[model samples]
Target: MSKELLKGNVAIAEAALRAGLQAYFGYPITPQTELLEHLSKRMIELDRVFLQAESEVAAINMVYGAACTGVRVMSSSSSPGVSLMQEGLSYIAGSELPCVIVDIMRGGPGLGNILPSQGDYFQVTRSAGHGDYRPIVLAPASVQEAIDFTVLAFDLADKYRHLVLVVADGLIGLMMEPCELPPFQPVRTTRPDWALTGADERERNVITSIYLKGEEMEGYNIKTQERLATIRATEQRWVEHLTDDCDLLIVGYGTAGRIAYTAIDEARSKGLRVGLLRPQTLYPFPEQRVAELAEQVERLLVVEMNAGQMLEDVKLAVAGRAPVDFFGRMGGMVPMPDEIVSAIDESFAKMAQPA
Candidate 1:
């Protein structure tokens, strides 16, 4: 397939469609609005399901309804808009419904800005909604990644019968890059065995998140935890850059990680043994890889576009094996390459100091 210059959000939208997405329900929100906009027309032209719901709340609930029918369904929104979908998300998750959600993160605490920010790190990774389950999160660093991860997100969601989130900062959402979209997959005609298709089967299938009895709820929780453990063990993914024989390591993801690549290259030219570990799966978190790298590096620096949210996870993974330092920008500020390089130097200097 020929690579086309595509914007991130549009690429994701098209990729989702080609991945056999049967339905799309979303509200318009900046940075991510283009995704819904693109789908709005394409879905109609293709005679697939597409609806602009009254609100983010309505959109996610609509996704919940569509997913119960065992179709490849999804929704997209920015940070605050995603917040509105949390309850519905929890409902979908509890019911063990497979669905995909895309979060094009924007600056926030409350309506912070429409610019890129990884502020939703905690919101998405540490259980996107209330309760113990964490969604499988894919962080895309470029437009190509955005496209690939969208397809992957659908597959993983169905494989596990759980929610999967493709998260990117506003930068990746708005940026344009050359990307080759996947070939279209035909939509599935038959519903899965577990789907609620009018209960006409030999045995009635009950799909729900509510376990009314205390013992039943506890049992369900145990089952969910076990599923999460399996996902964590098998799905941890990350990209290592110049990791071999490096004394200083950097940990970042999404846009922050993308910028760190440039900083690491510059730091390498400056004779610094700096490397980068960019996580692709945020929930699985690539903890094992980080722990292994921690044993080799003298210190680690974590960069973020938020107030060091993922820093805590990096620290936990290191477990005091190496000193972990953090640098971040909040409320829509993206760190520059030189800024990260400077932070790398500061980390080295800190390492040189007496404990």
Candidate 2:
């Protein structure tokens, strides 16, 4: 694999192409605009489909149309733009369509500035859309992980016939790092049997999110739940750094995750037995791993680019086996490595002291 330095957004667009993406639909939003810009010219050169939709809403529905044809399709936007695509995300989830959506999060209650923040953690993992459905959410801490996850998102989307959301912050999207884009064999327009493509070789296929009858809807909901259960069981992914035989553990993901590792290293130099647990999948959540590590560590300090969003999940995973504390920076601010190192030292002392 040849290595090249690329901005995260451009690497992702190139990765999607390498992953055989058949179509791309998106509108411009800061930090994520480069993705649209890169794909616009790249898609043209390959004679593939790419559209700068009138809006994020229009873009996602365009994905919906392409996905129904069993083609790998994607759309991307920053936090505010993603907020506008919620309805379409729900529709895609309800119809059980496979597609990838990228959210380069920015601070937002409404049209917040485009610096960098993980404020959309809840928006992506909990309630961005209007249904009782869950998307496979991936958080990548580096440009290489960004490229890798883009390819994995398409596979996971198709594997479950569901939506897969790649969660990033403005920092990840805008930053540059060396990455090896995977070589992919281009997939042509050979629609799947379940796809709604004229239905000539089999019975006609209908793709819609409508289930007017309550029982029919309930049945679909039950099936969706089963799919979620299976995903929870098998799809959880994460990385552990210096976790074994440690007294303090740091938990973070995406941009915050990388910082957590830096803090761990600094703490280690001072002879603190601290480690990091960087989650790659937010929804399935590496709960079991956290629980196992919690059994060994004295405390867990959750570092996030938001006000303690994933801290709640870490608390649940620890379940009183070990104490869980939080340190976060919201609204486009990032925590300094020393700040986290200080928190680790300070929190560990208090937790370790006999009362």
Candidate 3:
């Protein structure tokens, strides 16, 4: 395949289509609007389903309905827009439906701004809705990754019969880079046995989240937890740089991690033994790898565009085996490589001090 210079949002949209996306339902929001705009025309041209719903809430429900019919369905939105879909998200998860959701994060506790931010870490990794369920979350740092992960999100969702979220900040969404998209996959024509394809000759296959009885609900909850445990054990993923021999470790993800990679390279040039662990799977979180690295490093530093949201996870992984420090810029402020390099120096200084 030839590499084309593509904006992250458009790349993801095209990649999803090629990956056999049969239906798309979403409303436009900044940073991620291009994804929906691209799908609106392409889906129609391909004789697939595409509907611009009245709101995010409606869009998510549309996705839910399509997914129940066993088609590759998705929706894209920014932070606030994603919040509006939370209730719908919970319903889909509770029913064990497979679907993909793309969240291009913008500044926000409340309609913060249109700039990039990583404040959605907890919202995504913890739970996208009010439920005892944790959706699989993938954080991509580059335009290429945005395209790649979008494809992977659909596969993982179907494999586990669960929701999958591909999240990136506005930086990745708006940036342009060269990327090679996957070959087109023909959409499936046969519905899964579990799908609600209207009972014809056999007993009806009923699927619902409403297990009214206490024992029924508890039984379903146990099955959900078991599935999550399997996913956590098998799906933890991350990339490491200079980890073999380093006294200081830097942990970040998505945009923050991408920038930190540059800082760590510069620090290495200056004779600093600093490594990096950029997590790709945020929900599974690569905790085991972090725990092993914590034993090798003297200290750890977490960098982020938000106020250390991922920092707490690093601390848990470290488990006090090493000191942990955090440097962050909230409200859509991006940290430069030099700023992180300086942060590394400060961490070293702190390490040199007595406890």
Candidate 4:
């Protein structure tokens, strides 16, 4: 294994190649353009397919096409570009195409800005692509996690035959850190007997999400829901820090999660019993863990880069078992450690009852 200091986007690209990803389709977008460039340069040397599609829509559809061929494929974009790709994302979900889509999220809600933002939380976790489906959403907090999650994303996508999204922020994408590159894994080109790959011995398989009859769609939805339930039960992942004897728990993900870590450490140094609960998998959210923590902590503070988007999930998890409060910095502004610590202090103060 070679050790190198790499940016998060480059780490993801390298990880994808190591994980046996054979195809990459994407359009240039800020914060994630390095990912496309890195993959474009490396894929050619590896004799892999790398297409700079004309648009985000085209890129996602290209992922759809390549994925249908049973190839390990991926695409990535920032928030606005990802928004444009939603139509194809919806199609990918409906057709059960196994591919990974990375969103190095930037400020959004319509061409907002090209800075790190967690505004896409609801979009990714809730499957905002106009469908009753859920994509396995992985939120990476550091550059190392970015690499690890990219590999995990592919495995999960292929295992479940569904779309998996690596939902990171621009900060995580742009930051540099030491990363140990994993050895290249052999590509799996053998399609399952069930995958759509131009029938050789069996009948032609048609992959689609369109069911003309309402009853058929309802049945599909039920199956999808059951699968999601199983995933939630077995796949929820999170990282806890200093939670064993804490009065306040700070919850966040991605870059915000890292920032919260610093805040939690600072609060502990100052003699405050503060902890952190960082959800690594945002979709198969660690709701049960948060609920269990709620019983131990007096207050739970949800800190995010958006205006309380993740706070909703935190509150839902706590479910009145603990007082949940939100602290956010919007429009791509990330909160410093002091700001987050102050938020935690304020939350605890509010939770302190009057005599």
TM-score of each model, in listed order: 0.99, 0.98, 0.99, 0.98
**lDDT by residue for model 2 over 3-86, one digit each (tens)?**
899999999999999899889999999989999999999988998999998998899889889889999999999999998999
- lDDT-sorted candidate list, best first: 1, 3, 2, 4
The TM-score that candidate 3 achieves is 0.99
Per-candidate RMSD vs. true structure?
0.8, 1.1, 0.8, 1.1
Worst 10 residues of 2 by lDDT: 184-193
Task: Write down the lDDT of every candidate, Cα atoms only.
Answer: 0.94, 0.91, 0.94, 0.90
For residues 18-48, what per-residue lDDT tens digits would candidate 3 score against the true structure? 9999999999999899899999989999999
Measured by C-alpha RMSD in angstroms, how accurate is candidate 3? 0.8
Residue 267, candidate 2: C-alpha displacement in angstroms: 0.9
Better of 2 and 4 by lDDT: 2
- Which residue pairs in candidate 2 have backbone atoms (N, alpha carbon, C) closer than 3 angstroms, thus clashing? none
Task: Write model 4 residue lDDT over 297-345, tens digit each, in one string.
Answer: 8888888999888788888889999888888999999899999989978
CA lDDT, candidate 1, residue 339 = 99
Model 2 per-residue lDDT at 239: 94
